[model samples]
Target: MGGNQTQTQFILLGITDSPRVQMPLFVLFLLIYIVTLVGNVGIITLVRVSPSLHTPMYFFLTHFAFVDICYSTVVSPRMLADLLSEDKTISFADCMMQSQSFTHFAVVECHLLAMMAYDRHVAICHPLLYVTIISSRVCWQLVASSYLFAFLSAIICTWCTFGGSFCGPNRIDHFFCDVVPVLRLMCSDTHSSEMVIFAFVTINVVGTSIIILLSYISIIRTMLRMCSAQKRAKAFHTCASHLTAVALLYGSAFFMYLQPPSSHRSLDKVASILYAVLNPMLNPFIYSLRNKEVKGALVKCRRRFFNHWQQRSVVSSRT
Candidate 1:
């Protein structure tokens, strides 16, 4: 009777843990997960192998590609596995670790997107000063600072959430161990913890979002003043890609977090899908399709890859 009671108390959670949506959702996410990996990996490879693609813009873009890959990996695989399992239960320690890593990657991506915007601003508005303004040292510092802040935020949030109690029924309803879902599982009073999470989310989403808006405003104003139509058009095109990425990321994130708790859980799963899965998949296509340089590099990389393959075939045939 004691064992039966203990077994009954163990909570299982997530969308796929239900019978209604398991197979359909699993197939859908499997496709999305594959596309995300291929797209991000292709972008990274294209940027790395093409020498002409070396610039502050592509440098940051390469990192963005890597971050997208890491971000998706942090959540999607486990979520996919959970889809196939009968019991979608995560251990307390596993849940904490997932929350920490997911938060770290998500926060870093927020700042990194802002930094990319700043890069675009300098490149477009201060073409003469672009080299000096975005020097290697400055770029490295920006990347380093983004990672440092993300790590700090993740650590603080993890401490706040994980140190609390989970007395019973430890089920997280969403795919990954996000703050809201995990907090819902805790038995302890989580007012302070929720506040901390809210503050951090605000900084990453709202704070960086304001900065991005301001930068783009300045960029648009500067572009309007430019004498050359060609240059202005180029600047607008370059800025559009970054703008789209920023809009999608912050829009979904804010929608998820800014709402009252009553509305959070219902929207949590959908919001998590945007930044965690779709945003990463879109990042590569945004960069490649919008930026002439990235498109050119991709073309070059494809040609080279095929040429190398053909050469190997020819050599084997001759031998």
Candidate 2:
């Protein structure tokens, strides 16, 4: 219970300790991380460069893409390294840092999705007032609030988790220093921490989810009243990408964190991989494939990039 008995160095058991699967797992996660970076970064850049995407929806999307990149980077690279290396030890500071960063991104993303939903809600439900209501200044304020609140939330969570003493077995059961598994290692009482985490998670997850649900419900009702089928189709098309992103995020996140710490098992690592790794890698594809505007922007960007490369090649040949 005292500082003298506290252990600062913790060993992460990681996804597995199998020698045979190490290289394979390492290669697989490395690829996933690479794609996550490229995909999320591509979306962010595409939105920035494409003039057509200068709306409130794409504005929120750019921020969401950024968060996905950070969230994936927080765990995937470290998890990849641990998969290959025999030493999976992480210091107290590093583990807390990772958890805090991960939690911050996760919280930011949750509210961003809600704000995006509200953007869509205004766009569809109040078509005439959409521009005035969700103006550029308003969008910036929404994004700023999401990040600021999430930053504070992350500090509180990290404190709640690390405030307890870690004088017992220092081995973590997961690939990364997850809160539930890490809390299990604490020798001191974890009830308050777990309760605080539960409350934090409930407010963020459920509150944001409610916002999304209500926004969609309003959008749906507006869609139903549309006299023209084309208008209805267009509205659905607008929100589809965000809806897919929300589904993936909430489904995996709920599975990962909605339970008591005692209920956590090996399966939690799999859930972590789903949201933290796979979701980031999948979002770019989800948006680019489903949204015609994003697809058109991608095509335009590709053509410009290729044309520049071709001109440079011809210049080099002439020289």
Candidate number with greatest lDDT: 2
Candidate 2 residue lDDT tens string, 165-217: 88889999988877888899888888988999999999899999999999999
TM-scores, all models, native as reference: 0.91, 0.95
- Summing lDDT over every window of 10 consecutive residues in candidate 2, give the lowest-scoring window: 1-10
Write down the lDDT of every candidate, Cα atoms only. 0.81, 0.91
Error in Å for residue 219 of model 2: 0.5
- In model 2, the runs with Cα more than 4 Å from the true position are 1-5, 306-319
Candidate 2 displacement at residue 147 in angstroms: 0.9
Candidate 1 wrongly placed segments (more than 4 Å):
1-12, 17-20, 310-319
Which residue pairs does candidate 1 place in steric collision? none
